[model samples]
Target: MAVHRSRRWSFGGLALLVSAGLASAVLINTSDAATNRANAATVTTTTTFSDDFDGAAGSAPDSAKWSLETGGSGNGNHELEYYTNSTSNAALDGKGDLVVTARKNTDSGLQCWYGTCQYTSARLNTAKTFTQKYGHFESRIKVPKGQGVWPAFWMLGDDLGSVGWPGSGEIDVMENVGYEPGTVHGTIHGPGYSGAGGLGAAYTLPNGTSFADDFHTFAVDWSPSAITWSVDGQTYETRTPADAGSNKWVFDHPFDIILNFAVGGDWPGNPDSSTSFPQTMTVDYVHVTTSDSGSTSGSTGGSTGGTTRTGAIKGIGGMCVDVAGGSSDDGTPIQLHNCTGNDAQKWTLGSDGTVRALGKCLDVKAASHDDGAVVQLYTCNGTSAQQWTYTSAKDLTNTGADKCLDAKDNSSADGTRLQIWTCSGNANQKWTVG
Candidate 1:
C-alpha cells in the first residue's frame, strides 16, 4: 500500500493567469500579424544522424544519459519502486538493450515519502546530458504487461527548476498502460491544466496486437508548425497551435527527452490483483535527426526573410491604458487599450529582427532576467534588447545575447505575461519562421 500527499500550488495557477493575460494582449490581431509577412525562405534538407546501435560495444546505454526517480511509493496510484542510486531499485542491461524492471518487495520495512508501497521500478531522463531543439525523435521500445503499468517516452523543457513543471511544457511522444494495450497516446502539457490537465490524441494499433507484445518504433516528427506522432512509420495524430487556441499551444520551445515505466496514477489508475509484478520496459535505442540546410514546414509557414507573420495577438484584457509611453522599458505596466495602430499597440518586426512596438523595443522585464519574468516593450537601446535573429529552420533566436523571448512564469492563462530570459535551449524559446 502506498500513501500519497496532495498539496495545492496556488502560485502555479496565478502564474498561468498572468501568462494568459500577456499572450492575449501582445498576440492580438493575429490575422494582421499573418498578413504582414510574405512567404518564408525555402528549407534545406539534411540528416542529423541514423543510428542502429547494433554494435557489440561502444553503444550508448540509458546510464550515460538517464537518471531514475525513486520513492514515489504508489502515490497517484503508482506502482514503481523509486530508484535513486539507493537501495532496492536499479536499472540494468538485459542482453543488448537497456531494461528497466519493476519488482514487488516482500518486506514492509522500506518506507516512501508519501507512505508505503511494496514495489520498485525505474524512470530515466536526459536532463543535464543532452537535449534537442527541433528534430525527428524516435525510439524502439518493448512495453510491459499487466494492469496499472504505465510506460512512456516523452520530453519536457530542460528548464524544469527555473520555470517549474508544466509551465516549462511537456511533450508525450508515447504513453500506454496495461489496460489499454492497443492504444497509445500523444499529448502536450502547459500552464493552465497541465499534468492532470494534459491535452492530447491517441492511436490504436492494428491487427488487435498490443504494443506490449513486441518492439515498436514510437516517434514524433516535431517542427515549427506541427507535431506528429507515429508508430513505426505510421502517423496517428497531429497537433498544431493554430488548431488549438494560442493559449493551449506552447510547442515552439526546446524540450529534453525522458523514458519511464510507472505503475499507476490519476490517469492510468492502480493495478488489480491479476496484475503481474516484475514487469519490464526494454529500449533498444533512441535516435534524433535535423535537416542540414535549415528549412522546415507546417501551418506556421516557412521563413522567407520578407515581412511574414506566423501568429498574432488575439485580444488584450486587464491592461493598464494610462501608462506613459509604449517604449520598451523595465517594469513598464503593460495595459490593454483599444487598438489605435499607435506605436504602443503596433508591434513591428524589423528587417534587423527586433520586435518593436509602442516606440519601444520588446524588452525583458528588468532582465530580472530569470526564467519566468514578464515581457514588456521598452525604448530601443540597441542593446541585446533590440537584437533578434531569425533562423531559416523555423526558430527565432535572440542574437542580442543568445537569449530568447519567454512567457512570464510559463503560465497558460488568458492574461499571462511575456519576458526575455537566458536561453535554456528549450522549445518555449523556439519560434516558428513565417
Candidate 2:
C-alpha cells in the first residue's frame, strides 16, 4: 500500500517545465440563459444514507452503491494496463469511500491495447444504481503525483446506456495530475466538443502547493439556470446553457457519478522516465444532495457579479425566508433574515456536510425527524434537532423526527404559520423560490 499524499506538493519549476499552449485560453462570453427541459420523471424513493469517511474508523465503499469498470486501451494516450477486480486493483468496505490503487503488476492478468502497459488500477461508478437530476455533488480526494497520472472525479448522463457518450453529456468535477500539481480542471463534454473540444476551465491554487499533497473538496452545484464549480467553498468557474452551442446543451439530463484514476492518457501524455510507479488516488468520501423545485429562494453570491438563486446559499449572506408569515407552532416563520445575533434570524448554510446556527448546531431530532417536526433552535452541539435539510422542493425536515415544516392546511394566505405535521405530499410541503 502506498502512503496517501494528503499534503500540498512543491511546484516551483512548473512554469519552465510546461509550455503555455491552448490550456491557458479563457473564452469569455456574456449571456443569461437556462435550459427549459421538461423535468425527468423521477421516482419518489427513500434517500440512501451512509457514513462519509469522517468518523473514527475508515471503511470501504458500499458494494451496492458502486460498480467497478476495468480494461483500458488507453483512450487517446498510450497508458498502462487495466485494473481487474484483483488484490492489486480495487476493493470496497461499505463505509462510503472507495480506494483505487495503481501499481506495476505483470501477473495481474490485466492488459491494455495501448503503449508499454505495466500497471493496474480502478474506475468506479453509480450509473444504474443511483442518479440525480439537479443538486450538489462533491468528493474529497487526494490525487497521485507524477507526470501522466490522471485522476478524475466526474459525472456522465445516466441515460448514457441508450443515448451513448458525448450526446449524453459529461461533467468533470475534478481532473489533476503530477505535471500540473497545483492546477485542476473542470469541464463539460457534449456533442460538438465531447472528447477534446468540449467547453471547460482550469483553476490553479495559490503558487507553491500542489493538490497531490492534501485532500481537497471538489464540487459542482447544478441547477436549472447554471452550473458552478468550487474548491472547498470558494467558486472557481461557472457555466450556463446559453454559453454552450445548440448541440452542446446536454446538461439538462440527469448524470451519474464516477471516480477513477488513470495512468498515462492522450490528454496528460505519457509518464516520463523520471515518473514514479505505484501512484494512487485516495477518496475521502462522495456526497450528493438534491433540492425540490422552488424550495428556497435566494441568489448564489460569489466573486462573479451574476447572482442566480438555486436553493442552496452559494455564498455568505445568502438567505431564503418567508417574510409573509409565522410558524404554526406559534413561532415566526423562518425568514431569510440578515445575519443578526437573534436565534430566529440566524441560519447555518451547508453544502453537504452539516448545519450550524446561533451558538448551537442544528440537528435532526432522533435522527428520524420527519415531516412537521417543530424546527427549534438548539445548542451548537452536533445533535439531531439542528440537522434540518431543505430539499430542492424546499421541504424542511429534521433527520431525527418524522415531522416536517408544513404550511398550516396548505394555506397560501399571509401569516400562514408553519407547523409540524405528518409527511404529506402537498403544496404546503412544496417550496419554490430558486
Quantify all predictions' global Cα lDDT against the true fold: 0.52, 0.52
Minimum summed lDDT over a 10-residue window in model 1 is located at 17-26
Residue 184, candidate 2: alpha-carbon lDDT: 89
Where is model 2 more than 4 Å wrong at Cα?
Answer: 1-60, 92-97, 292-434
lDDT of 2 by residue, 209-255 (tens): 89988888887766655677767644556778887756658776556
Best by TM-score: 2
